[model samples]
Target: MTWLITGGAGYIGAHVVRAMTGAGERTVVYDDLSTGDAGRVPREVPLVVGSVLDGGRLARAIAAHQVTGVVHLAAKKQVGESVGRPLHYYHENVEGLRVLLEAVTAAPVTAFVFSSSAAVYGMPDVDVVTEETPCRPLSPYGETKLAGEWLVRAAGRAAGLATASLRYFNVAGAATPALADTGVSNLVPMVFHRLTEGTAPRVFGDDYPTADGTCVRDYIHVVDLAEAHVTVARALRSTPGLDLTLNVGRGEGVSVREMIDRINAVTGYDHPPTIAPRRPGDPARVVASADRIATELGWRAAHDVQDMITSAWEGWVRLHPAAARA
Candidate 1:
C-alpha cells in the first residue's frame, strides 16, 4: 500500500519517511519546504513540493501517487511564536488540516495518522497525563492541535476513515545520519547551538514544584517517535477498529536544569548554564503515561535522556564542527 507523508522532509516527518522506506513500503512525500529540507528526503522517494492549503495540488498529488493512507505532519509548531501570532497558527494549522481533509474525502483514503502534540494537556495538576486527560491548552499552538484532533475525529466518523492522532511530547535527537540545517526547535539543539558559540546556554525557570524546581518535560527520541508512527500505520492496516488518540512519551519528566547538566556532562563543557526567568505561559511539569500505545500497539520509547542528548549532539557537531570545541 502506498502512503502519503505530508511534511515528510521535516524533522520528525523525515524520520518517519525513512522508517516507512526501511520497512519496504511504498511512500511519497508532500512538503511545502517552509521549514523542511528537500535533501532530507531520500532520492528514491517521490517528492511533491506543494502546500496542504492548496486543495488542487493536494488532490493531484493524492491521485497521482494513488496514496491509500496519509500521515499528516505539516504544521506551524512553536509555543512562543504561536502566542505572538495566534491568527497565523490558526490559519496554518487549522486551515491546512481542513484543506487536507477535503482532499482525503475527495480521494476516499482509507486510513489517516495525525501528528499531534501533548500541548493539548497544558499544565495538568497531576504530573502524568493519560489519553483521557482534559485538554486545556495554554497557547495557540496547543489550541490548534486540539482543534485538529477534533476535526480528524469528526471527519473520520463521517467518512468511515480510520484515524489515529499521536499526541507526542518533546521529540529530540536525530534519527538518520543526515542532519537538519534549519528550523531546529527542540531544547537540545538550541542548547547545542549556544554551547558551540562559546556562550552558556540559558535555562528558563529554576523555581517550579518539581524536584529541581525547574520546569520538567518528557522528551522522546525522534527515532522512537517515528517508529510509533509506523506501528500506528500497521495497526490501521491490521485492525480497522483501532481509531483513537494515544500519547507517545517515556512516562518521565526531566527538568530544564537536569537537561543542561546532562548536556554539560556529555559535551564536557566547564561553563554553567545561564538561568533565566520563565517565559510566560510556561508549564510547570508535563509527562505522559503512554500505557495505551504500549498495550495496544506494542510500542515503547527505546532511547533515554543520554541517547537523546548524545545523538542530538553528534548531529549538531556534524553540521557545525566548530561548535563542538571548547
Candidate 2:
C-alpha cells in the first residue's frame, strides 16, 4: 500500500517512516516542518510540504501520491503549552485532524492509523491503564487526542474506513543517532540535559504513594513504538472497516527516581536527582496493560529500560559531544 505519513519529518514520525519503508511499504512524507526536520526524511521517500489544515493541499497530495493509507502524527503535544493556549491546541490538533479526515474520507484512502496518546487517560486512577479506562483528560493536549480518536473512529464507521488509534505510552530511544529526538521535553532527555550541564536532575515530588515516593510511568522505545505503528497500519490495510483502540507499551512501570538512577548508570554519572514538590495533576502510576494489543497483534516490546537508556545516550552524545567526556 502507498502510505502518506503526515509529520514524517519529526522524531517519532521519521522512525515510523523508516520502519514502514524498511518493511517494504511505499511511503510519502507530508510535513509542515514546524518542529520536523526535512533532513530526517529518507531520500527515497517523497516529502510533501503542506499542512493538515489545508484541505486542498491534502487532497492534491493524496491524489498525486495515490496514497491508499495514512498515518497522521502532526499535532501540538506539549501539555503545559496546551494548558496556556487551549485554543491553539484545539485548532492545530482537533481541527487539523478533522480537515485531514475529510480529505481522507473523500479520497480513496481506505485505512488510517492515528497517533493517539496515553495523555487521554490524564492522571488515571489505576495501576495499569487499559483501553477501556474512563478518559478524563486534565489538559487540553489530552483532550485534543481523545477528540481526535473520536473523530477518527466516527469517520471510519461512517465512511467504511478501517482505522486504528494506538494510544502510545512514554516514547524514548531512537533507531539511530541521526534519528534521535532533539527536543528536551521528555524525561530521558531532560535528565541528560541536566547531567550534561553538571547539575542535579530534578525529581518532581518524591512523596507519592510508591516504593520510591515518585511518579511511576511506562516508557516504550521509539523504535518499538514505530514498529507498533507499522503493525497497526498493516492490520488496518488488511481488515476492512476494522476499528481498534489499543495501548502500545511494555506493561511495566518505572519510578521517576529509578529512571534517574538508571540514567546516571547508563551515562556513567553518579549525580543523584534532587527532590522537588510534586507537580499538580501528576499521577502516581500510569502503566499500560498491553494485553489487548498483544492478544490482537502478537506484538510485544523487545527493548527493556536499559536498552532504552543505552541507545538514547548514544544519540545524546551524538548531539552533545561534551556529554560523553563530562
Candidate 3:
C-alpha cells in the first residue's frame, strides 16, 4: 500500500521519507515547498506539489497514489512567529488539517500518523509530561497543534480510522548530507550556525530555577524521531484500536547551558554564549515522559547528546567545510 507524507520535503519530513523509502515502501511526498525544498526529496520518489489547504488537489493526489495511509507533518512551526500571527497559525495548522481530514474522510483512507508537538503541554508545572497530561498550550503554535490533535481524535472516533499523534519535543540533529541549509528555526542548527560564523550562540534567560539557571529541554535525535514514525505506521497496520497520542522523546531534559557546553566541546568553539533576557512564553523547563510509546510500541531512542551533536556537526561541516574551520 502507498503512504502519503505531507511536507515530505522538510527537514523532519525528509528524514521520514528517507526512512520510508529506505525500507522499500511505496511513498508519495506532498509539499508546497513554502519552507521545504523540492531538491531535498529523494529523486526516485514521486512528489505532489500542492498545499494541504487545497482539498481538491489533496484528494486527487491521495486517490491517484492509491494511498492507504498518511503521515501528516505540514504546519507553521515557529513559536515566536506563531505568536505574532495567530490567525496565520490557525489557518495553516488548523484549517490545513481540517482540509486534509475532510479529504481523508471522503477518500476512506484510515491509517494516519500525526506530527504533534510538546508545545501542546505549554509550560506544564511538571517537568516531564506524559500522554495523559492536560493540555494548556501557551503560544498560538501550541494551540494550533492541540487543535489539530483534537481534529484527529474526533475524525478517528467518528470514522473508525486508526490514528497516532506523536508529540515531539525539541527535535534536533540532522540525518542527511545536505543539512547546513536545513533552516534556522531550530536551536541546535542556529547555534551551530552562530559558532561556525565565529560568533557565540545566544542564550536566553540564565536565571530560571534549573541547575545553571537556563531552560531544559528534551532534544531527541531526528533519526530516532523518524524511527518512531516507522513504528507508528507499523502499529497502525497491526494494532486494532484507534486514536493514539504518545510523546516521542528521549525522556531526559538537557539544559541550554549544558547543550552549549556540549556543542563547544564537540566543535572546539571557545567563544562564550551571549546572555539575553528570556522571551515571553519561554518555559523554564520542558521534558518528555515517553514511557507510553516505549511500553506500547517497544521503541527507544538510541542516540545520546554526543551522537546528536556529532552527527549535526558532521552534517554541517560536510555542507560547509569553511564554516567548520572557523
Question: What TM-score fits each model?
Answer: 0.97, 0.97, 0.97
What C-alpha lDDT values do all the predictions have? 0.89, 0.93, 0.88
What is the Å distance of residue 257 in model 1 from its true position? 0.5
TM-score of 1: 0.97
* RMSD values, in order shown: 1.3, 1.2, 1.3
Error of 1 at 15 (Å): 0.2
Candidate 2 colliding pairs: none
Residue 221's lDDT within candidate 1 is 91
> Ranking under lDDT, best-scoring first?
2, 1, 3
**Segments of candidate 3 deviating more than 4 angstroms:** 179-181
Misplaced by over 4 Å in model 1 are 180-184
lDDT digits (tens) for residues 1-326 of candidate 2: 89999999998999999999999999999999999999999899999999999999999999999999999999998887888899999999999999999999999999999999998998887888999999988889999999999999999999999999999999999899888888988899999999999999999897788897998999999999999988898899888999999999999999999999999989998889898886644667889999998999989999999988988899999999989964
lDDT of 1 by residue, 1-326 (tens): 79999999899999999999998778999999999999998999999999999999999999998998999999999898899999999999999999999999888588899999999998899879999989999999999999999999999888888899999998888764475423446788888778777898887878888897888999999999989999999888776645879999999988888898899899877668888988766789999999999998899999999988888887877777776756
Error of 1 at 118 (Å): 0.6
